[model samples]
Target: MIPHIHRRTFGTGSRPVLAIHCSLAHSGAWRGVGAALSDIATLHAYDLPNHGKSGDWDGQGVMHDTATDMALAVLDEIGPVDVIGHSFGATVALRLAIEHPMRICSTILFEPVYFAPLMADDPGFAGGYRHDTAAYDQALEAGDTAAAAKAFNSTWGDTAAWDTLPEASRTYMAERIHFVRDSAPFLMNDSADLLAPGRFAQATGPVLLMRGETSPWAEDLNGAIARRLPNVQEVSLPDLGHMAPITHPDRVATHVRSFWAAQGQGLRSARL
Candidate 1:
């Protein structure tokens, strides 16, 4: 059984859109996107366990369990919803759509980081990802929390990003390094099942998969995901990286709203 998770609802529209943020982020991160779609969507964002205001999870910190927790929250508070998730959150959303297809009318994901597809297609790429991530993993092993956070963020985000962080932000991230460290292994290693043939075949929904053009490894990773989903439309944003949702929320919101608006037509007609 999943524990009760904390959620924040934005807008007053009757049509609901459940937003799940990436690792180390929270519901507040979805504010910009929520605001962008306020005219047509009631955004329901949740803080996954150990991320934001939500309490720490009691059991394992795996993606499937996290997805279940989010699903439970939807059942209790919002019922079925149009879903949007970013990075790790996107991975969870994909699982939920497959496991509970009836609950999601449409889905939008920003660089879901499952990595299984890349690994399967290119051994060298998989090895490089592990090597790059070793810096963060090693720091965790050596009990250098700040270094771990910096290394992990630098690889997926910006190289100088860590040093530029304000002291308070640095301290907070350092404090949460343990959660990041523990969760990283499950996300990176649990690819066998996630990449299983036809894993996404059962998920029936219109999916929008967006990735930043500057993202280092996303081309292959996101491409792999797009090929699997039955009805998926992939969009690439120029001059943006993996952190676009956080760094360039307004621009990202524009693209997202456009995609949602198009999908909303079928939903609106169904409602009437």
Candidate 2:
């Protein structure tokens, strides 16, 4: 059984929307971005099992189980939705779509952190991640939150533009990264090829798989997955990297808005 989960929702309209946070981050990442998308429809963002306001899942750290609980929780909390995910959250979004085909209208993934092949291309990538996690955990246990935060920022927690963030944003992340360091990798569901075969290869809804042009690796795998999906759209943002939503929210919003517009009234008229 899963524990209770909490989410933040925005907007109020016919189309329901949800955003799942990447590791080392929380639903707050989508605050400004969600505001932009909310006008078109409703938006909801999750805090993950141990992140944000959600209760910890204890031993259920595996990605599949976490994704399952989250998928059920989101639909139960805000009804069915169209999901958008970034990084590890995107991987969970993909899993949720596969596990519960009936809950999603459409899916958008921005650089899901699918390891395996991606990590293999760069030896020690996953190992480095594990090393960072351990180091941060040690730092936290030693009561050196600054050192822990610095260790995280040195790897995945800190961003090039993070110091410029507002005080509130900084505070929010400071409180959230503890859960991120604890929960993200466990919810990654990394397989030999990243995602499951029939899951990504034979998806049932519209999937917008995207990557940044300057992104160092993993585009090949994401592209390959996109090609296999029945109704998938592939996109690349040359100027963007891992932080597409933050680096180019306007562009991402445009691409999504256009996708939604093109579908028009025909968009998921019949529920999956």
Cα lDDT listed for each candidate: 0.76, 0.68
**lDDT for position 177 in model 1:** 72
100 in model 1: Cα distance from truth in Å? Answer: 1.1
What does candidate 2's lDDT look like per residue over 1-272, in tens digits? 66667778766556788788776566777766676676787768877766677776666445446645775777786766788888778877776666666778888888876654445345656676576478777988887765676566655432465566676756655665565445445333353233445655445878888888766454765764565567888888876777777657777777777777766665567763
- Stretches off by above 4 angstroms in model 2 are 61-64, 117-158, 161-197
Which candidate has the highest TM-score of all?
1
Please give the distance, in angstroms, between residue 257's alpha carbon in candidate 1 and its true position after superposition: 2.1
Q: Where does candidate 2 clash, by residue pair?
A: 153-158
Model 1 lDDT tens row, 12-98: 777778888877677888887777667777888888777677777666546457655665567556677778888888887887777
lDDT of 2 at 132: 48
Poorly placed runs, candidate 1 (over 4 Å): 61-63, 184-186, 267-272
Write down the RMSD of candidate 1 (Cα, Å). 2.4
| Model 2 residue 262 lDDT score | 68
The local distance difference test score of model 2 is 0.68
